[model samples]
Target: MATCAEEVSKTKLVVAAIDFGTTYSGYAFAFQKDYSSDHHSLRIYGIMSKNGCSQKAPTCVLFNPQGKFDSFGYDAENRYAELTLTNEHQDWYYFRRFKMMLYNNPNITWHSILKDDKGKSMNAIKVFSAIISYLRQETLRNINERVANVGIKENEINWVLTVPAIWSDQAKQFMREAAKKAGIHSDQLDIALEPEAASIYCKHISVSRRERQETHGAEGVGLEAMCPGTKYLVLDAGGGTIDITVQRVQENGTLHQVYMANGGDWGGTKVDEAYEAFLEELVGQNIWEAFKAKYMDSYIDIFREFETKKRTISPDIENRITFTVPPVLRDVYEEMKNSPLSTTQGHHRNRKLIWKGDRLRVDVTEAKKLFETTCALIVAHVERILDKEETAGTSDILMVGGFSESPMLSNAIKERFGHTKRVIIPEEAGLSVLKGAVLFGFDTRVVSLRVMKHTYGIQSSSLFRKNLDPDITKTMVKGKLYCEDRFSKHVKKGQSVRIDEETQTIDYHPLDDREEMAVKVYITDKYDPEYCDTELCSYIGQLLVCLPMDVPTSDRGVKVNMKFGGTELSVRATVMATNQTTHAEFRLLE
Candidate 1:
């Protein structure tokens, strides 16, 4: 018989999964908890927040009255109307879609990003830190609020954060740094790839469960397999970027043969911009332009407000929004008033129009059409790779990330590939990766995914010649650009090499007379730099090859030996040599 005292030792720490996405972020936690009939259930998972109402959290933040939080999640969403209006003071505001802005602007800093729409100074990271800090606090709070939320302290908790599969090491490095700056514990931190994380939730232990439900139909059932050499593609179209990765699944939480991941900077937000453009066209460009010129920030504010209303109502119906703005916008206001468009209502409370004007609206069908360029290209790319003459037997296509949540997007996929190989949209489309990271962080049995590393280079000349698109090509280099690439085989742009790596070495010297040593490690997939000109993906750090000067002199070529690691291949290149030692040491540094 077990004593009650012994039962207290059975509980373990809870694990939190963080999905730090460009558009939004979310966290989930799991632990063993006591259940009905005095039994303990393992792998109890729940969304972490003040209230665990939703599994995903919007990664947007805003400043409220007096620079306070007017709303967060449903709280903020409910009062979107009240929050949209400006009062006595013409204070600025903030909203989503700033992630890419930081990259485009070189002057952007932690303080620089927090500025309101008016360019007023504020601390963006500080606000993000506050939100994340509150999240961390609320996780502990929610854990405490639960029946057995138990007595878990912050120190006892473990967490893992997931990033886009296409995120560069620099991005991950930035995240690690930012996570720390935001007060998140490094010890609690673990990094996992986005698609791999989603696979965890998609292929959860349901089949392994004692009882399972029938899984199949027109929507398609996910084929869950955690074995060696299982190949899959992760089509992650999110708010800001589209990340596509093709890799072989390993037995453990490791990836192999991961070469086929690429991303397009365009995503849903681009479509949203196009949508705004369409609405502007419906309202007349001149009118919209006038509004923009007179009231730049207010123009953006009004557009955002229109977008909010668009989300809720039918495009056929007339709708109105009321908000105040700078007085300079009065000209545009008069034009809108005089226009032939229907004026459903009017009120001038805060130096703004409180009127519903015109029958201008966009139907969902038209909205989807606006996304044609984006959707078609994404589909075409995926199809092109999948239909490659090689690897015809590849297993399946796994669609993960936030963009896959789009009903129109998925429908387009289903319409296109209904009969082909399996197309799976994981059940937990959004939070799947975060959950997968939780399981991955614990070293649990999982199908490992692999992605390749690529080093890019440009031709010594003509990298960007006139009438030519910048040549972008992938090369076989290993490791980080300035680090260990020589030891690693990374395939940049056009290199369709298999997703694995082996080591190799080559040696050569002396490009000029009396120089004794001049070598450029031209590692590339293209034989001719002219034809295969890609933009400079990468280049060698300044490394000069020079002879020992004490070596014997010669007028003929000399041979130098080099070795590559994984491939274990070696080569001796004969080059112009004026001097050489019978033997010399040449090895990679520590």
Candidate 2:
């Protein structure tokens, strides 16, 4: 049996997880004692919605004129809307779906700034930290209210924060710093990839045998029933990004990633953007821009209404899709164009656009078109993954996250691969990541191995060769020729590494009597990159090792060891002369 290596199940009395999503956010937790029991259950945060209890609230935050956190989630949305209705929200800052800013941002750091819904600027870290703080408070309040005499101290609780599998290392580090600012100690927190967490949740849950047979045919029965060596695909379709991961089960009951996580920004928000684009064209760009600028509250309300209707959209629906059109939209159009909004209807080539009193009616055909591009891209990507030799024999595609709840997208997947592959959408798919994160906190060893997405290495200098080293990169060090910016690869792309496995130690000598040697980490998409400064290479983080003054100049060397198996990269250096190990943390997002 695999023992708990982290503090979650051992030293911590509670394991709480926060799913800080792009469009929605929520928390779940279970006591340690309960976690050890077979009857343990996760207490997920929920708020009442039109469809009943909602496991998550909108991922939005409100700040006062002083730029201090005012509220978050549903409260923030409501408060901002109320202020907007009264024309008093101009001074206040409101941020929605701001998490996407970190995605693909190479220069993202603690000092990065973010613009609010009204273009007001604030420190991005502050905004993220405030949201995390609110969630932390909520988690504590719930734990206190639910349990008796638990007396859970801050040190006794382990926290898990979920991020998309496709997020960059800097983004993950940024979240860690935000959590630290929210009063979570670095040691007590663990970053869980969204797709991996969802996989862990599926691993523990059982589907009805009859339902599994009806859906999967002869491929597999359910997630829990999958024996060792069974490979499947996980599509984490969230609001901001669709993260894909191919996983295979091990005999030890742990997941082994067959392929690195890969996906694009083709998510639910893309469909919303498509709908907005249609509306922009129908109302005229000038009118729509002015409406969003002046009537910001009503503009938000329009999308809020659409979000509710978006869930109910289906390919089989015959009636025209209807969206409540705030009166301000027409007023803004009239004010700008000196005519009713309907006048622009004739200008639209898409004859399906029509105005029905207080509602905007769109033909089912046009509405389906909104999902066409995103669905097509997602399908194509999935097909490409399945076609790869690595993902061969993968018969099941597990869909999780908020976007997976879309009937239209679900239909798209089923129509495309349902004939040959089993597409399993777990119950309460949106909460899968959150619940699984809680489980991950309880046992961090559920994922035994992972395939590296990029080739990771350290920037180094070695003896130059005329044929292999470019002339521009050749430089003299201590009267000898050396090649700068050489990539000393620690782990290659597509390489499988067990959890906490350390790479082979490489010794390095300080150049030019430098007091400290900097281990600059770089990553690349290529399997083998020779240079670190190439177009395809990206410098991620660095670790500095101090050289001992007592050691001779030539003997001042450090043996660097890097652990590339976990969600974050860890480095430790051993002094060559003293044989003493110095664990150094990467200064990520600096």
- Residues 1-590, candidate 1, lDDT per residue (tens digit)? 00111122223366666666555666667654332222212354556443342356555555655776544443443344343443322453444555554334333333445555446555555555555665666666666666353487765666666666555433444455556676766656656666656665554432221111222332334344546666666677777777776656556534543454566666667666776675455446777676654454455445445434323432233433222233434446466768444343332222222224323233344544556777787888778777765446567676776667665566667667756655666554656676676665554223332323443222221122334432242222333122112222223333443212222323332323454343323234443333322343333321234444444444434544432211111233333453343332211111
Give candidate 2 regions above 4 Å deviation: 1-8, 39-53, 208-224, 343-347, 466-468
Residue-by-residue lDDT tens digits, candidate 2, 1-590? 01123644577888889899888888888877766766234444422233343568888999999988899877887788788777898899999998999895778887899999868899999999999999899888888877647566888888899999898888888998999999988888898999999988877774424347755585565344667888999999999999999999889988999999999999899999998998898778888988887777787778788887888899999998888988878888888888665632443674666685678777888888889999999999999999999999997898988899888998999999999988888888888899889889988878988899999988999999989789999999879999988999999999999887889999888886767777788999898899999889988887777777787887778898877778777677888989987645677777
* TM-score of every prediction relative to native: 0.61, 0.93
Top-scoring candidate (TM-score): 2
In the predicted model 2, the residue pairs found to clash are none
Highest lDDT: give the candidate number.
2
Clashes of each: 34, 0
| Range of the 10 consecutive residues with the lowest summed lDDT in candidate 2 | 44-53
Q: What is the lDDT of candidate 1?
A: 0.49
